[model samples]
Target: MSKNKVHYLKKLEIISKINTQGLTVRSVSHDYNISVSTIKDWLRLYDSFGISGLVPGTSIKYPNEIKMKAIEDILVNHLSKADVLKKYKITQNSVLNHWIKRYNNDKTLKQRGVGVRKMNKGRITTFIERIAIVKEIIASDFNYQALSEQSGVSYQQSYSWTQKYKAHGEQGLQDRRGKSRSSDQQLTETEQLKIENKALKAKNELLEIENQLAKKLLEFEKDVTRSL
Candidate 1:
């Protein structure tokens, strides 16, 4: 197993004990020599996604349907952020906040095509250069493609960077391709947990049904053999 999966299993073990053994988070933290906050976060994840949420090294993606449902629950149905989060198994208000912004802006949940353009001559642009290019685009009223030609970068790159910079300031320009942030990073922990938890629960349920069917099939085979 991957190290992340192993670590998840370990956390799952501790969380299971907390639930089954009726132990408090503090007590479990002391026993496992883990931080109380970490243990609490693990418990929250377990509660949200079961064992699958505890699985490490996997990035979860939410579908447009789920995103729309969450948005409707908040905007149309008038649910509070906490209520929406709990209902949808989301971990952060920021996710809903972002969704609301997109909805208001008439943007779709789908990523724009701006990021798909080929890089300029396959050369990676520096952060400083990217920031400068994005600023110029913004100053030019978000004429990203025009500015991209001048900056020797992809229009997609310029537009995407400008969007990120607009939403998150300069820090968003930092490349986060391979690194995994804690639940609180760009997306809230709860938001990610919800997606993973839902997927894991569905998988677990399917596996349970399959196991039951296998047991029945084995019993039927034994019975036929005996009769024959």
Candidate 2:
């Protein structure tokens, strides 16, 4: 939930404690203040493939053998989607669902790459487009999945854009390629100027919107007072 990466060892330890200590998923989740879904995912991965399945990071490539085995376990053994997910150590049930769909349509078990392929995977998004998508996501009550489906962007992309927008406003959505601000030394004059300009532009836009909203609220209040 914090967006900070949890080490796989920590996840494995939590799952082990749940099993060896006979703790319920809800109890473990409440004790650690982690979401129940997160804990259950860890348990499923560990149970399905042992320690190897609990590896961290999203860029992991599942071998064709593993994919086929998962399919067989589900189709031939008549396992439920959840059961196959737990038995195959899949991180997302959607991955299995996609495989099932592909098998049904083509009778093949080929695994597609992660994320939406509409714009060549990590698409180069314009600042205006990113801002619009972020705004639409906010209008949809932060439904990342719905935003991804409707906008043809991956759910991870939608979520990441929203997070960047929240953290740094519109400028955060900018494609700051080849710019690293984590260095100890001062930034170059050009880099500093670019950053300052972006920040100023974003701030000015935010202030203008805030001023408009304030004026509208004041007018509405005055109308209400007059009517009363």
Candidate 3:
């Protein structure tokens, strides 16, 4: 599996959650900290090719004529992107977007080669870098794929770090295995403040979720009272 790519098995799990468990794309996105667009892409791909569609580098290489036709259906016939994807079985919008850009620019329709694309392997990162990437993931609305590419780490790495940060605070991001207690316990004032701040953020987020649930519960109770 490529470092930057999400594994097909994980994609299948997400698809199952949405399809079999009756979860909405947005809810799955929130729970998994992935982008809604990315989830939608996976759903469309799975719809077209089942588990195989979710596999990285399995997309079909369309002829130039097909590309032009798909683009025309969108640009001239006013088809929705989703509709076009279904019609053509294209797995990703990014590919069609590229074709659209070229067609609009009056470029010639040329068939591109098909095959797996080469991506750089994920690189190791320090503790500080992990913290920065996790912060960026939160700031970007939990777009883990984008952060993974930007941070030169695997999607798994970015997602795991964020999960740990949420579940265990700053200490979760540290790789203290095989280290002595003295070094692990040592922390500068600023780093200590960061740990405190991250914990508070996690607590505040929990509070926000609880507050929303409480409001919904109150609404339900009011409806029950009115009915009685």
Candidate 4:
């Protein structure tokens, strides 16, 4: 198991907490605290995957004890990581880090921490979903109208997604459309009309060129008829 200074400090706290309560690493880590391997795994996760891995909480995607237990059970039963991910909906990265944390320096496996807890904020769920959408938009370079049509979210919601992305970087884009912008971001009808007018003028100029070419063809046909 790998860990950083912060994670090591957290482990010391877990150790102290358990010691004050007079518990062993096996019982304490499994019940009162996350496993030592889990701590080291989180540190490793931080080292390799960065902060996203160490974020404390559960995902809306998977919120069942039986399921979490199934993960540990599979690992204990000696099933592969790929197999665990297939049975459960979690990503391979998540499963790997979780198991690494669960086993840490301890060789034995335990089910004491199977108690499932709910994630705290409803807004976080929304924020994560919004971030996923914004990431898609940035990757594709597709704007709001296209996103609205494809995603079946409202036009206003799509624009809100972009604004949230532009303002908040990745974290701001997470699970939220964010607060409303000032009126200055809104375009007036007059401004919209001017834009439309410019487009129409450009189209009309293209049509005029096509019409002049047709006239030249007609003149050429008349000359051919007279020559014949």
Clashes of each: 4, 0, 0, 8
The top-ranked prediction according to TM-score is 3
Q: What TM-score does model 4 achieve against the real structure?
A: 0.22
Q: Candidate 4, after superposition: displacement of residue 205 in Å? A: 0.8
What tens digits encode model 1's per-residue C-alpha lDDT throughout 32-89?
A: 7778766765666567655545555333455444666677777668887766766777
lDDT of 3 by residue, 71-113 (tens): 7788778999889988989867888898877755642332211
Q: Rank the candidates by lDDT, best first.
A: 3, 2, 1, 4
Show model 1 residue runs off by greater than 4 Å.
1-6, 29-41, 75-83, 91-101, 104-106, 109-228
1-228 per-residue lDDT for model 4 (tens digits): 233334433554554555476666567556644656554344343333233334344232333333445555565577766455545444335655665576443333232223222121112224444655555555434443344445555545655677866987645544324766545444467754554565456456656866896686567545644643
Query: Compared with the true structure, what per-residue lDDT tens digits does model 2 show for residues 166-202?
Result: 9998668777678654333334677555655654565
At residue 130, what lDDT does model 2 achieve?
71
Q: Could you tell me how far off, in angstroms, the CA of residue 158 lies in candidate 4 after the best superposition?
A: 19
Per-model TM values vs. the true structure: 0.35, 0.36, 0.42, 0.22
Better of 2 and 3 by TM-score: 3
Please rank every candidate by TM-score, starting with the best: 3, 2, 1, 4
- Taken over the whole model, the C-alpha lDDT of each candidate is 0.61, 0.64, 0.70, 0.48
Off by over 4 Å in 4: 1-182
- Model 4 lDDT, residue 153, Cα: 58
